[model samples]
Target: MHFDLADLRLFVHIAESPSLTQGARRAHLSAAAASARIKALESQLDSRLLYRDNRGVELTPSGQRLLQHARLILRQVERLKDDFSEQGGDQAGHIRIFANTTAVTEFLPEVLAGFLAARPAVTVDLQERLNRDIVRAILDGSADLGIVAGPVRAEGLEILHFSTDHLVLAVPPGHALERLGRPPTLADTLGYFHVGLHEGSTLQSFLREQVERLGGTLNLRIQVASFEAACRMIEAGVGIGVLPETAARRHQRSMGLSILQLDEPWVVRERSVLVREREALPGCARTLVELLRQVGDGVVAP
Candidate 1:
């Protein structure tokens, strides 16, 4: 019924690695010590927490729930320590952020570079995630902040306008799609082969969802990791691609790519920043949020 931070930390490592030996090594304990700890945890909780197999270990449902709580607890403890350290003039902190693909690849890099440059003792852990997932992570205390596009469903989290962007079709100049004499809709372009973003990209997932809603599939000829790569492929006439207008415009002239506006309502995207509570955030995290707002407002060029 009672366990310490060490127990929670050890459990998290084991669940993440799914290897007793590796988890033990990470916790600076031997395999036997780690195994004993796990057994003690299971007995204390009165639940089976893992499933063992030749491959590795898998968390049981109970273990999955525990993992979530453990992460949240550890994060809160870190935040407390960071607050105390900063107040003591050490100014050391770590901020975790979850953002969608556009924010990750297009928006945050320049802003983060400036933020990190001024605060050498501050570190950021930025990750790309789906919009909804980003919102959930913020609510769960797993992420200090989030940048997401489209509508946000987070009820209690603070949402600030981040930026506005639109998805556009990028094709080779004089391509068949460009010759349509009008802006082509996503449905119209589905028939053509397309260069797409990587499978895990939020933008790529959004495109697929839209395609499915229209009862069609994206005819992707190849998948690349970035908007630039997609534009390069489109310029080579490999296939057409959907890209954020901001990114597409940057490469349009150099790549000889034609940008076609999509005739769908969802094409227009609004990005927002989500925070649990502004006043409750660590000092460094609050500063970063302010910087993000400035960039979003065009006070600072990104």
Candidate 2:
């Protein structure tokens, strides 16, 4: 039998609350209107739906069965409306994104600006977290896309390499490492006290792996959770650190710190763009990914 979604909505609301008065309150209808809708639905189905008693309302056997179907039908109807709205081809829906600290602060500004300029109707929401957290957002469908560092592994997700950012050595102006004319090897650099961020960061992981590959380990003097804290310690001559070039440039002059390009063997970290499905990406999300590719084209050589 065919029934209107409005009828099903009223039924579910009544079934959930089991009290016509409360259901009407929840659905923003008067008692008479709610009872009328429920009676109409019961007539259309040719069955007794509810039994009235001192406990307010109780469902008949048929009513209990129809309640489940009503909930499913209402959910599908809502999904259909959302799908059609998003397919309106107006580029005027919400898009959520996840990104790491470096990308959020240093990389996405220009790309996001260009996107907002072109698609004025679209609204962008962004959050900053570590690479793993960003990946989790995409997998759980909480974010439409994610920008992160290397080593993302998930089924049905396509990872695209967009840029490669080197980890530069930053030292206080008067620090021993700053007195050297040329950059030192990972081994030689570790001979001095080292300041670094805590271990969970992708950048920190990358540095540790590279150092281990060269048969050495960092003598970390202090490990803080934030890059700003690490930079502060480095500026105070507590030790040297390997930080992103983008971040280093932002605070180097003001913080009285100097950044030196490490030797060729120590170049670390490559930034990547990730999407759940490249071919089926939403229109606005696809556009943003393309813009990032264009901007970082020369930054990462293939």
Candidate 3:
């Protein structure tokens, strides 16, 4: 029995969207056509692949298992084709990457520059989003890779540690917190007005948990979406904010802010690079991953 690549592609899309109508839109096919294809694939394999419910579709156990092999086969086929076509001279392709702002500004530029210098014909499409969105992008296959400030665990994604950052407390110059000679505990931090990223974001999630564990409450005065915004708010004396050390350091001089170490041990953040699956990475995606790994190892050329 033979399975068509189109069928596998459709299946993956279905798994990602879970709604037949939405999946068809993403695949640029009509609902009837997408349903017919799924039906045909299921009939050909003599197995039910999906279950449609009132809300959306879900992959059966068999379908879930097949997805792994499907991705591996497709990636291998593409890689084989690329290998026979060229030997990596000015490789022509595009890679989709999603990253958080810190990585977008701090880490990605050097790796991207090196990749471009080596493969000028290729193009990099980068989107700066929050860590949660970055995780979803990788799982949906919309992004070939994701760089995020938190660990991502999903059905089909593999995460590799890329870097670690400290989450430092930032206060405007001469703020009361800045003058505190001793590191503030949870109780002390909560007394100060807080500015932080909005809910449903990685930093917010992490901070909320830490605050809860510390048995303290945050004033939570302002909720901004970006780290830069948080820093600016702190500089304006809106409130104290927590931000990545790299970002806070970069802007502290200009913003006239002071970075204070939190008294708790949970203030450090680890960042990672995520791929949908290792064996399914396209040639371009593999090269990009290599660049990230090399950069993480501090072996990249300046």
The per-model lDDT (C-alpha) reads: 0.86, 0.75, 0.78
- Taking the tens digit of each residue's C-alpha lDDT, what string does model 3 give over 45-76? 88899999899999898887777667656656
Q: Write the per-residue lDDT of candidate 2 for residues 191-274, one digit (tens) a residue.
A: 888888776666777678888888888899999876778888988989998888878877775797888888855476677887
| Candidate 1 lDDT over residue span 18-105, tens digit each | 5878888889999899888899899999999988777888999999888888877887687688767834322567888999888889
Model 1 lDDT at residue 86: 38
For model 3, the local distance difference test gives: 0.78
Q: How many backbone clashes can be found in candidate 3?
A: 0
Listed in order, each prediction's TM-score against the native is: 0.89, 0.60, 0.77
What is the lDDT for 57 in model 2? 90
Ranking by TM-score: 1, 3, 2
Task: Show the colliding residue pairs in model 1.
Answer: none
> How far in Å is the alpha carbon of 197 misplaced in model 2?
3.3
